[model samples]
Target: MAEVTTSPRTWSPAAAPPHAPHSGGPRWRVVVGSYGFRLTLVVLLALAAAVGILTYGNPAAPGSSGFWVIVRSRFASVGTILVVAFCQGVATVVFHTVTNNRILTPSILGFDALYRVIQTALVFLFGAGTLAATDGLGKIALQSLLMVGFASLLYGWLFTGTKANLHLLLLVGVVLGMGFGSLSTFMQRLLTPSEFDILSARLFGNISASDASYLPWGALVCVVVGTVLWRRRHVLDVVALGRETATSLGVRHQREVLLTLVLVAVLISVSTSMVGPMTFFGFVVAMLTYQVVGDSRHTRTLPMVAAVACATLLGAYFVLRHVFYAAGLVSVIIELAGGLVFLVHLLRKGLR
Candidate 1:
C-alpha cells in the first residue's frame, strides 16, 4: 500500500469544522426547545390555577345546592372566557395570515362595527327591555347570519375577478366600517343617557355580560369553525405567502381567501355576539402569539395563540375578580392594555 501518511489532524480551533446546526435534531427535542412549548406549559398552568380559584370553594357547604349553583356559574363564566379567547385568537390569526398583514385583524373588516350597529339598532328600534327580553339564541343566530351574509356578499362581489382585489376589498371594508361606526355614533348621540348606558354596557367586551344561555350555540359554532380552520392550517401557511405565491403553489388563492374571510366573519359574529366588541383583544393576542411562538406555521402558532388568549383572559379575570374585586373592569383593562401595546409596537416600528 502506498505510504498511508495521514495528514496530521488539525488541532487549531480555527481549523475545526463548525458544529452542525441542530436542524436535524429529533422532532420532539426541537419542539421542546421552541418557545411555543414552554409558553404553552406556562399558559396551561395559569389557566388551571385560574379555573381552580374561580370555581373552587363556596360560602355554602361543599355539596350543598348553593355551592353547586356557585360552581355552575363560575364554570359558565370560564366557558365564556375560553370561547371568546378561541374565537378572537383563531379569527385574528387566520385573518392576518390570509391578508398578509400583521397589524390588521378581523375587526378592521367591520365585524365589530357591524356588531355595534346591530346592537345599537336593536336598542334604538325596540327599547332596551325588549332587547334584553329577546331570546339569546335568536339574537346570536340573527347576528351571525347578518354578518356572514354581508361578508359573503362583499367578498363574493369583490373577489369575482381573475385576481381578487384584496386591497380594494380592504378599502371597501374600511369605508363600510367607518360608515357603520358613524351611524352608530349618531344613533348613540341621539339616545337618552339611560339607553346610552345600556348600549355602552353591551359595547364593551365583558365576561359577566356573556349569557350562559348562549354558551351551547357559541361553543358549537366555535368548534365547527375552529375545526375547519385547524384542518386548513397548512393551507393557511401557503395563503400567508401572498396571493401570487399561493396561486403558484396550486392553492385556490381567491377561493381560499374568500373562505377564510367568511370563517373569520362567522367567528367574529360568535365572539362579538357573545361578549360584545373586543376591538383590540384579538390584535393583542395575535401579536403576543407570534412573539411567543416565533414561527409562522399556523399549526405551531394557532394553539399558542389560543393559549395566550386564554391565559390572558383567565389571568386578568382572576386578578380582577379575586384580587382587585373589580371584575366589571376586565374588558376595559384589556382594551386599555392592548391599546397601549399597539401604540408601543407602532412606536418601536417607527423608531426602527
Candidate 2:
C-alpha cells in the first residue's frame, strides 16, 4: 500500500543556450587591416620592382654585352634565389608552427651543417681545383642529393623516437655543425697559399659568375618541389596547427612533416649549391614575412611574402655589390647584414 504513492515528475525539453554574437571581423580581415601589414606589402613590392629593374636587360642591343651577360647569368640564380626564398620561408614558418616557436629555422636541423661538411670533404679529399674543373652542375646536384639523404635520415630517426626531446635534436645539430666547422678549419689550415686561394674561391658565391648551365636542372627541381608545396597548401596550413590537432583534422602530420623536411632540404640544396651557405638569410626573410603577415596562414603568407623579402634583400645586395663592394665580396656583405639582423633579433629577444 505504501508503494502505491508516487510523486508527480515534470517532463521538460532541454533548453538550448544562446548563440554568441558575430565578431566585428574575421581574423584575416583584422590581420590585413594592420598598418604594419600594409607597410610590409608596400615595401616588399617596391623591392621586388627594384630587383626586376636590376635583373632586366636588353640583350640584343650593341654595347649591352655585360648587361646581357648579367641577365643571362641570373637564370639559375634567379630560380635558385626564388626557390630558396619560398622554400626557406615556407619551411621556417611551418617549422615555427610545428614547434610553436618563432625563432627557429631549417639550419637548426643541421641540414646546412651537413651540406658544409660534404663540401669541405669534397675539397679536402679531391682537392679544390678538381671541383672547379669538374662539371659544376653535376657536382652541385650530387652534393645536394647527398644533403637531402642525410636530412631525411636525420628526420626519420628524430621523428621515429630516436630522440626523446626536440631540443636534443637541435643540440645534436649544433654539435654536428661545430664538428663540421672544426674539420673545415683544420683542412683550411693545412692548405698551401695557392691551395688556400683555390679553396676560398670555391667556398663563396659570385652571382655574376653563376653558371647559367645549371639553370634548366635547378629550375626543374625547384618547380617540382614548389608545385608540390603549392598544391598541398591547405595541408601545410593544417600542419601549422601542430601535430595532434593536424592529425585530429585528418592531416597526416608525420608524413607532412617529413615531406616538408625534404622540401626544405631541396630548397637549401639549391640555394647553397648556387651561392654557398648564407647564414641567417632565411631567418631574416622569414622573420620579416611573419612580422608583415601578422598571421600564420601559409596559403597567402609563406611563399609570396618570402619571395618578396628575398627579392628585396637580393636587390639591395645587387645595388650594394655595384656600389660599395665593386670589387669586394657580395657574400661577405650579405653575411654582414644578415649577421647584424641576427644580433638585433637576439638582443631584442633577450631584452624581452
Candidate 3:
C-alpha cells in the first residue's frame, strides 16, 4: 500500500514553474529527425552509387575507352534530374505551405499551364523552326522571368485580404489552371497537325532527345531559383502556420508569401521548361516529406528532405531507363506513378 500526500502549492497549476528544456538525448542527433529525411538520404546516396554503376560498369561498351562517353551522358542526365528535383520540390512545398493545403501542387495554381501558354504562343507567333533556332538559354531565362512576373501578379491579391482560406485558395487556383489549360487546348487546335504534334509533346512534359538541348539554360535557372528558396527557408517555417498566426508572430506574411510564390514560379518554370510539365512530382515529394518528417518547419526539413526525394525518384528512373526499359520517356513513367500517388492521397484525405 502507498500513502499519497500532495501540498496545496503543488496542486495549483498556476504555481508550477515553466517546463525545463529536455536533455539526455543523443549528442549528435540529426536535426528534424524525420523518417523522410533518413529515407531520402539513403535513397539519394544509393542512387549516386547506381549512377556510378551505370556509367562505369556497362557491358555494351566493348572497351574501357567508352567510360568517358558513359560518364558524359550520365553527367548530363544527373544534372538535369538534380535541377528538376530541386525546382519541383521547393516550389511545391512553398506553394502548399503558403496556401495551407497538402492537396495542391504548383501546377494547380497555373504555374505549369502558364508555361505551356507561353510556349504555345511563342510557337504560334514565330514559326516552329525559328523558335527552335532561338538561343535555348535565353529562352529559359526569359521564360522564368515571365513566370516570376506572372506569379507576383497573381499572388498580389491575396496580400490585400485579411486571411486566406485553404479550400478557397485551392478552388481559385484550380479554376485558373483550368482556364489556362482550356486556352492552351484552343491554341493547339488551331495549329497544323505537325505543329500540334510538337505542341502535344511539349504539353506532356517530354524529356527526350529533342529537348535535351535546353539543359544548360534550364540548369542555370534552376540554380538561381534554388538559391533563392534556400535563402528563405527560415521564413517558410513561419509561413506554414497560416497568414494570421504568422503575422501575429511579427512575420511579414504577405510580402514573404508573395516572394515565395514568385520564387516557386521561377523554379517551376525552369523545370517545366527543361522536361515539360510534371503535374504530380512535387505533390508526391512534398507530401511524402511532410508525412516522413512529421514537422512543417522548412528550416531543417524542407530542402534536404524534398531534394533527396526528388533526386531519388529521378535517379531511379534513370537507372530503370538505362538498365531495364531503355525505350520509353522516363518522365511519362514518373508522371504515371506520381499521379497514382496523388489520387491515393486525395482519396485518403476525402475519407478523413
Each prediction's TM-score versus the true structure: 0.88, 0.77, 0.79
lDDT of each candidate versus the true structure: 0.86, 0.68, 0.70
After superposition, candidate 1 runs with Cα above 4 Å error: 1-32, 61-66
Worst 10 residues of 3 by lDDT: 19-28
- Residue 92, candidate 3: alpha-carbon lDDT: 80
- On residues 311-338, what C-alpha lDDT tens digit does candidate 1 reach at each position? 8888888888877888889999999998
Candidate 3, residues 1-352, lDDT tens digits: the string is: 8999986644556555554233325422644364555765756674764465446456555456776666666565666676677778777878887877777788877777888888788778785665567647677678778877776766776556767444555577788888888987788778888887766666675443434566677767767776777787777888888777899999987788777777777788788767778888877777777766667777656655555655656665656666676424677767888999989988998899
For all predictions, the C-alpha RMSD in Å is 4.8, 10.2, 8.5
> Best to worst by lDDT, what's the order?
1, 3, 2
Candidate 1 has a TM-score of: 0.88
Could you tell me the lDDT of residue 15 within candidate 2?
42
Candidate 2 structure quality by residue, lDDT tens digits, 226-248? 78877888888888777779989
